[model samples]
Target: MYTPKDFVESRLPVLHDAIRANAFGTLVTAGEGGIEATHVPFVLARDEGPMGTLYAHVARGNDHVARHAGEVLSMFTGPHAYISPNGYPGKATHHREVPTWNYIAVHAYGTAETFTDPDRLLDLLSRLTEQSEHDTGQAQPWKLSDAPADYVAPMLRGIVGIRIPIARIEGKWKLGQNRPAADREGSARLLEQCPGDNEQAIAEAMRSV
Candidate 1:
């Protein structure tokens, strides 16, 4: 990310929250065949490493995982919305404002490894399912053991589990931190009125700043 000084966010807790809320990330790696990317949901093991560890899986047929090695990146994107120039209160005076966008994101880098053991894969699936179900407020959430072992065993065989021990992390919160108070407030009001959930989220973020 080409983050400006005003938009840089290095706080660990905030970065972790961003990753937790946006568990799905774009996983990218470079190999002999050039670059490959996959969109997948991740499970964060915050205590596993200095920066934290990431867990996810890809289809058995996905050649990207087989070719992946060395450093890889996972990008988590949070709330984002367009800021129209007309929303700026100063636009009437200066008439020089331009449209911009506001958003939050995090990038994690680490060396990735694959897991092929059936037992490990089963554990990974169980944890992932549990996390997702719990986040969605399912009082009686589904579990891996809910299905017959014979069915799950065969299904698990068709995927590959992956682990990334994160070495570095970066976060960016471009929520008009550089803008004047009046402009920020005006844009936030417009964002709050927008129908999209992300736009409303940006409005909330603006208010906090």
Candidate 2:
């Protein structure tokens, strides 16, 4: 999160968009056992608080579930790619540019709490499922109700619901904004020709910036 002034993104809507687009995130917390991190998919409630609220879950047996009531950090990573100096227009003239990375990331800080109520957990699961299914663009998206209630009940009981009302948030879009306009444009164009999805995504993000 060491963001330079040119790369800092504080807009609430922009931060929220990044979180929604990259829903899978790492949740970090410090406890007696030191720092622990869990990777999970999160659901954002944009209007739930001043910043927003995050919803996710961990297995009931997970140590994280036992140490949930505290300040925590959730990190969402978006598209990223290696920026080769060869792509820089200035490289040919000055040979001063070095390789760097371009990426989008958001960090959310909040106090986390756990819930065990069956109804609330069920609602959380439904929302998570609905969002994921929508992203898959399936004609028949699956729902929690599609499964037998008895089977789903046992599954829900095996996990704990987590809710974090965001206290603060930070977004960093390291999309070569610090470079000269010509260099930035040149790098983005080169990235678009790359084969990977991440390279293409970084290129698009750079152009939009």
Candidate 3:
């Protein structure tokens, strides 16, 4: 993650919050054939391990199921926005600032294992669904039980559950912490004026820092 000292975030709770907020992550592994990556949503068990445990599922036919062994990396990306030098308060005077990006990202490293237990897989699916539905602010969140057992059974059989107890974790919050306060504030203001959700989020994060 090539994080500078100013951007490094080592707090456990902070890292956990980032993972939970951005649960859909890229899982990377190296095998005899080559490196493989899979994008999946992960459920974090914060108290399960020293760092945390991640639960996810992949299709039974996914090559990741067979190739994922030993060390694995899961990357979670949070809000990000491009910062234009024009937003810097001192740009007019010094003309030294260049464009850059502000973002939050977390990397988790662990050993991955796969399971076929129907009950465990079902539980994983339910938790993922519940979290996603809650995020949508639905009046009634969907549950696994909403579907027929027979129909779900076949679906469950088509996938494999993955468990990874985090051994190492790193977080980087590049919210212009290294920049001058006036410049940071100026950039944040510009970010808020941008049209995307991510830009707004980055602006908020910059304010907090």
Candidate 4:
């Protein structure tokens, strides 16, 4: 991300929230054949540094995982909305005003190691399920231990767990900060009434800006 100083989100907590809220990320890597990418849900761990670790898994048959093991990029996408110049109060004064996109995103660069251990893979799956299901109400949640060993054993071979040690992380927030206050207010007002979730998100982001 070509993040300008004004738009940079350097706070580790904010960056971590971005990753957690948007757990799904695109993994990119290169190998002898060429570049490959895969979309996967990631589990982010925040320990030291403003940066954090990324844990995810792919199908055993996915060749992309092998190439991405040593190094990879995990991207997280936050709320994004379209901002029309019409929403700007200064549109009349600034005839050159144009529509723009308001959004936030984070890119994580890291080195990954794949785990072939069956027990580890099971543990990873448990953690992933718990994290993802936290918000959803499931009176009786599902668990690997609840499943029979015979069925679970075959399932384990189908996936591979990969751990990525964080090398770098970048976050960008573009919420019409460059626009005049009047324009910002106007755009935010229009967004609040918009029906889509994305538009509502923009409305909230503008308030923060």
The estimated TM-scores of all candidates read 0.96, 0.97, 0.97, 0.92
Question: What is candidate 2's lDDT per residue for 1-209, written digit by digit as tens?
Answer: 79999999999999999999999999999888788899999999999999999999989998585665578999999999999999988789999989999999999999888898999999999999999999999999999899999999999889999999999999999998888888788999999899999999999899888
Model 3 C-alpha lDDT per residue in residues 1-209, reported as the tens digit of each score:
89999999999999999999999999999888788899999999999989989999999999685765589999999999999998898889989889999999999999998899999999999999998888998888888899999999999999999999999999999999999899889999998888999999999999998
lDDT of 3: 0.93
Task: Report residue 97 deviation for candidate 2 (angstroms).
Answer: 1.3
lDDT of 4 by residue, 1-209 (tens): 89878788878788899899889889888777778889999988788444778889989998677754466788899999999888886677767788889999999898878887999888888888888777567887776677798998989999999888788888999987877778888999988888999999888888887
Q: Each model's C-alpha lDDT? A: 0.90, 0.93, 0.93, 0.85
Candidate 1 ranges with C-alpha deviation above 4 Å: none
- Candidate 4, residue 89: Cα displacement in angstroms equals 0.5
State the weakest 10-residue window (summed lDDT) of model 2: 62-71
Off by over 4 Å in 3: none
RMSD of each: 1.1, 1.0, 0.9, 1.8
Model 3 deviation from native, Cα RMSD in Å: 0.9
- Clashes (candidate 3): 0
lDDT of 4: 0.85
| lDDT over C-alpha atoms for residue 14 of model 3 | 97
